[model samples]
Target: MRDIYAGSTEVIVWLGESGPKDHLGEMILPMLTADEIASLYQWHGDRRDLPKLAAYVSKVVEDRRKTGSAQDSIDIFGAFYVLSALISGVEASGIQELRHLHKSGPILRGFDALMQPRWWSRAWVVQEVVVAQSVTIRYGKLSAPWKIFSQAASQYERARLEANADSTYPYLKEQSLARFSRMILEIETTRNDWNQAEPVGLLSLLRKFRSRSSSDERDKVFALLGLVRFWRINEKKIMPDYHIDAIKVSFETTKSLLASVGSLSVLAGTLRYSECCDSNPSWVIDWNYPPTTNEDTRLFNLPWYCAGGSDGLIELHKQRVLKIEASYLDEVISVGEELVETTITRMRPVIMDWTKLCAQFIDTRPSFEHAHYIGGGSVGDAFWRTICGNLEFVKMGVNTSNFATTTVKKGFRKATADGSLAFEQLRSADYSHRRTTSIIGGFWQESNQPDPEIARRNAFHHAVECACEGRRFFVTKTGYIGVGPRNMSVGDHAFIPHGSQVPFILRNADRLVACQGDQIETLSSATGSQPTYIPAGKHAKAPEQQKVCYEAHSELYFVIGDAYVHGVMNGEAVRLETQAFWKTTSICLI
Candidate 1:
């Protein structure tokens, strides 16, 4: 392969078949040994693996040099990994996959198989394809550039998302297409030569490729080592070490990252115990499970007041515990269990269903004060705003003044006053007012007759979709409202530890004994045993007895979920004056 790159070899040909064409104008099949066939199918014969294979070829060539052989080194192979006759020439464009066809039709069946190849999920293929100088995909005699393949994959994804959005679209088998699209898009983004001024951080990269598979679990980190830039001065600690176990590798990588970044932002990749305990530490993120919800979206959209200070650091002690420099905030005095809820299997064009869900939540409120307490504002006002999807009306530049004067808000106010309005009636009134307003002064005034009412309804539906889908909505014992992952249990604590951006759901580590796998169980389980005083080198200690008391210093909590507590988002729900002072603390996670 290096010879080809060095202009020594003219070209390297790859044959799809070993036998010659038959006299009847059909190719004669070659009998292949199991080993030969298995080798051919390895890595799905992807073109992206060529560069890594070339490295091995280079090693062999160097060995020949030491032997003083007469043969010239084959520096480059200019290789092509071909898939022969995978798709018919007529249907190769993939447009037919979007159309309705017979359930067992051959065309759709073949396309499904083509899209579902394991090659798309392999960790090695990510680097191979991204680093390759050139690639050409051949399907029998028909050929397409890699660029063309990528564009097609993107189009397929857009079509799939559109189909999912429309209730009228026929049922489509989209798993294969979706997987292929994500793989190709990742290759496009991760290439070193790609002109990205600001590279994605390690946390974002890990989250993005979490679902990619690896035969050896540790390769999940090792394969991407080449792509991780040493952006931070201390990030140089992220070096590839194939010798270590997967668990140690994960811990070390996270420790190095935390040391370099100096923030708990790394916890953005953390998952629920049930989802990650088998493969990852209690504190380290498991980058194998794909995210079920848009936690990143919430992270970016959070109000500025929730931002944490920079005086935070993480210490890994004895390779089993994490000592964090954090401010001690509120403790979880009480919490409720997970709510029994229905998943949104498909997108609904109307917002009525979501409005009813919100109304049900309002009805669960213990008192009028609880409503205003959950989300900052009057109980009636918060209820109406959430129902109307007007929580960010001013920030989003929507006409809230007009919205306030609309019949929708008036009827909602009347309902609160009379205490007789049903959720269905409130929805109907909101829709009626929106439609009337759109017809009077909205885009409908033009001949195009654009339905702003539909847009408004869709916007409301989208907001609820993001807030509720794949999420668990829970109420604290004191009537505080927050949403977390669906796996959240009744006893999980909602805590806003100081120096943390958002509230985190915590579980008692002691109770996790039954579920802790052998690997995690070996780690320390005592949260109280972590050292309370700073090490001698980092800070001077007071007199022996005057040193901070272990119990009085700080408390640690397990991070279960990143929460969106309605009343606490603005920092008004929990007052700092009443709580303990913000002191650096250590959270012991197994």
Candidate 2:
């Protein structure tokens, strides 16, 4: 199907209430109606519609011109006439307005050449390479790169000279470009001063932009300042070895000399020590030991130094002090407690599931080797006891309900007062917290499981656990009932503790009755433990019977593989990514 306005050349025709075409003879009425022509100009944001309208106008103009009609009678044929007619029609139709016309304005303006048609016939972009060669002819012998650039420049000159006997270099009119080129010639001039201060080219560029008179130019100057600030803060972090490279002075050094010096010039002295500085030097508040009140002067590490005196340094210090004193001081004190609770909550299911599974695996191992590591003598029993204790706690809905609230309220003070040695170990002078220690103990024992293999398997297991907990694990009890809410029952869900009973009641079409409570005795294997069942009432509706929930088993676990390890021997060490015990399959039994 061909588009209505497919051709490169466009013609537009518009009809208003007072169109000139109303005077046309009845002979031409069958070929075109003014109403139909007006409807053709009605369109949305489309540029194609304009051309379609234009084509119809061109036909009318041709018809009038061939008839020897006066140019005044043919005003509809002019490009601007066609444009105004189309705009007015679109506005009248309520389909569009002039404000929406900007999108196609530039394209429409370019179409003025279309009236001639011949000039725009060829494709615009031609295949040609622009060869740019910059040469820095230092006062003495040029460096290899400079020499090569000079040679290329000379060759370009020779080729131009050959191309024309009478030649001129047009760029000579820009005297700054010539000055820039000559400066590149003096490379060796500042070779000795290169490392003594910041590069002059960078400084010069900053100065030029900083001193600009126009608002746009000043904006660019501020942008440069912001970039410098970013570089100063992040240089050590992003490129720790950047300062190691020696300065390579060349004739191009003059470009550095051209930059105007500002506040950044003061940074040159401090920059000397930046190579040894830390990227993120956190402030440590030793709450246990107050700052020596006896001392009049105290020296502390500041990430930035003052260019002037104590006032400048103190002002910067006060800004940070006020900021912390205003908001983060209390927040910092509070976050430790918050993090402690958050960590436990996040690790809850993981710890539960892992510990339980470790016990299960220990209980049902196919061979002695599987049992030897986690099993041995009391280890197996100790693990089983732990799992049972925890599982029963869950089935009984026994958790630190008020315990968490109390802990958070008490804050780190509890941990501090209780003498948790881990906190003190973290505070050891020999331990730099910046270099993180993954394992407080040492590396994982070489289980029959391959190192990477164990990690990959454990990751999949952990992901599954996280997914299940995210969706199904209940955070609150609403429909719960029991002797102190001992259990929860979803229909068909297995019960862990024996003795819990579920009672179901039907209440017409509008409501249902349910009751949950403890059982007289738990179903038990004389040798082990049994899962309990909650019976439904005989009067319960068939669908209502489905609402009866039995107590669910508490099954969650954690295996202890060392999470991090450091070595005192030979300064060598290994770390296991997962601190888990279960390997999932016999292939991971190693």
Candidate 3:
């Protein structure tokens, strides 16, 4: 199919009647220059280390800021002006000149509307469009190059992120257009990525398009098979077989990829990434679930650490039970509030509650000068980083990205470094104000800084919010501070699989497999963690606090997705090399 499509002269994509293709000529093109449109697309995905390209893009934006061309202003503000004139009951002729300014709003809501077409999301459409020799998108009678829609979607997203600085409309920015920008740009990027003529692995394709729209559940894997260049050796192993069940296809595909690639990376795809995650094995990647991960964010593509230690043994028994060597870190002893949503109202309370939770384990003074933890960082530094999952936003397109970990956590770090002000401030009569304002005020207050830092701050805030949005703050039995999945519990554990880059949270699969027909398997490698395996049909009468409760759980655990433990993040856990403290052992996962 790919070869045939590539040989074709041209592919004319009909993007329905209301998509960006229809509005490209009259609306989007009028507002943005060719360079700006290209720049929008370039910034659509992850930040590649392209110094020359990034510099060129910076120049274009600077030029636009310096010279907002007459047409640009008219195109931007003309729609609102034209609408107001009509509301005032002006003559139609008087409004005629400014009426065309209707195109001006394309930078805002108009562009969002243009991205509304369903064609951009169709999973089956990818191979045809991407493999084609040349492509154009048409809507109704209007036709435009595919580049117009592909690139335009990213600009609206960039604008949406920048607009959050308007505190009044911060909620509005969160609610609208930003998601559409993400969707279209992802679709566009995959298409462009395939055009590079590189042979992509099947695992990459599965992760990349996991959230894409597909009418048939099986199409999620089948549709991407043509693009899997690395799977030719095992091509017969994973061919499209519609006769098979969708869940079976998904389950088999996971095994096939792991077998072919010979890596444990796919373990990261389970639990959080799987949809209908209930019935399937905790280790399998269900295609139905939208793996809504931000690849460009903190968890991935950052300064990676090998906290998983050295790879040892990886075996799949009956191609069902996932047995691998993982360094067992700590069981979650206490669970803090789960940050359920990404709203301005919820963010403050969640962070505050988390801070209080940290306070239980360590000190947070009025001046916040304390450090008693695993990694040797100050108390304040550990608290803030753990809450945000140890993430900072860099390369956020128009939003500045140079805000370093040292720079971001320094003010809070300073509070930890010096206890001189702490005692005096506590003794002062105005200690109440000093206590409250010194910590949260310094961290959370909205800054009206100069433009660039404001964008950087907004981006930073967004990174923290998004990173912790659906996760809960957790304290390990060993006094480690971190954040895990929303559904994580007190007995759930955090570990680093030998081959994985980040730590993952997992819960005992005892009750999880009780409902399913899976057999209980004890998975441990010399840790004296030989907990009694209670069959799925049986019950453990002990409560969570009791040893026989979930705490004395077996090695077989269900994944709760990736996590950020402050001490373990930078590989100190691996460095310690003490089995009793943190053991590198084999554990079973569903």
lDDT of candidate 1 over 405-461, digit per residue (tens): 532331121123212132222244332332332223111211223344433433343
Clash list (residue pairs), candidate 3 = 75-104, 275-289, 283-590
How close is every model to the real structure, measured as TM-score? 0.57, 0.12, 0.66
Model 3 C-alpha lDDT per residue in residues 1-590, reported as the tens digit of each score: 87888889998877565433222222233346565555332221222313322332254542552354333232212222222333343422233321222222233453344445776666777787777877776545444455544554544444434333434334433343456556656656667667775656666677666767888989998888777654433222467798998878877787665544333545553344432355567777777776544532333332344555434344554445666777788888888977765554446666777767877765445544465665675666676656544544443343324445644431122112223232222122221222222213112223322344344445445556656766778888767788777777888888877655568888776532121323322222222121232221223122211111122224677777777778776666666657576667767667
- Where in model 1 is the C-alpha error above 4 Å? 1-97, 101-111, 139-142, 153-166, 173-180, 270-281, 293-313, 325-371, 378-469, 510-556, 570-587
Rank by TM-score, descending?
3, 1, 2
Candidate that scores best on lDDT: 3
Residue-pair clashes per prediction, in order, are 10, 37, 3
Off by over 4 Å in 2: 1-349, 352-354, 357-362, 365-462, 471-590
Candidate 1 accuracy as lDDT: 0.42
